[model samples]
Target: MINRPETRDLLAEARQVLLDSLVPELGGERKYEALMIANAMGMAIREQEQQEAGEPESTDVMLSRFLAGHALPEESEQGEQTLARALRERVVDGSDRELRAVLRAMTETRLKVNNPGYLK
Candidate 1:
């Protein structure tokens, strides 16, 4: 049986059309703008697919792992806040090498879903 197109699937088709047809017809600034929009749409589609497939919806997993490096104190609202503050401070006060590694992972995680252009 045929199924209705899901929103993500529709967006995927739209992005394909934008690149295969619309982009070819454009030039200069307009072409760049279309590419930007297409890129955003592609990211959105990938995010949705990842979510539907039981993958993480965001970078919380990586950040949580990083934070887990330290022993979390007693679990409480205030305790959680303190732990978070401590984690932030540690990252900021960390050695250049340590900070660079953590920050690099953080930026890479964000870029995976936001704008991965620099990776190219």
Candidate 2:
């Protein structure tokens, strides 16, 4: 599991890389910013993998575990909006490197599934 400090360090480094290396090369284009934004999105998704196995359900689990507590909501009531909101809040509020890494991985996973660049 990733502690808070680790997540902060990673985000700091990623921000540096984005500012120092990526931004300059893209000539201040929004598309280049999109790439970095997409990467950070992927990293946030990866944080869920750090959960322990076989733990009993609890409030902490509900808040921290991505897939946890999802069963409570009906299909009609639940959708991408809820998840998206949660994700946005978490990544923005969090300062953890591991969580950011998870977000980055998540972004990659989403890209693999259906990215505009891959359209025929």
RMSD for each of the candidates: 5.0, 15.1
lDDT of 1 by residue, 1-120 (tens): 898989998999999999999999999999999999999998998677666764452344444544455554435544335445775777335554543565666566556667768767
TM-score of each: 0.58, 0.25
Best by lDDT: 1
Error of 1 at 10 (Å): 0.4
For residues 9-119, could you state the per-residue lDDT of candidate 2 as single tens digits? 566577667766766667556757657685664445343322322222232333344434433232454434444565676633355454455455555444543452553
Which candidate gets the maximum TM-score versus the true structure?
1
lDDT, model 1:
0.69
Task: List clashing residue pairs in candidate 1.
Answer: none
lDDT of 1 at 112: 61
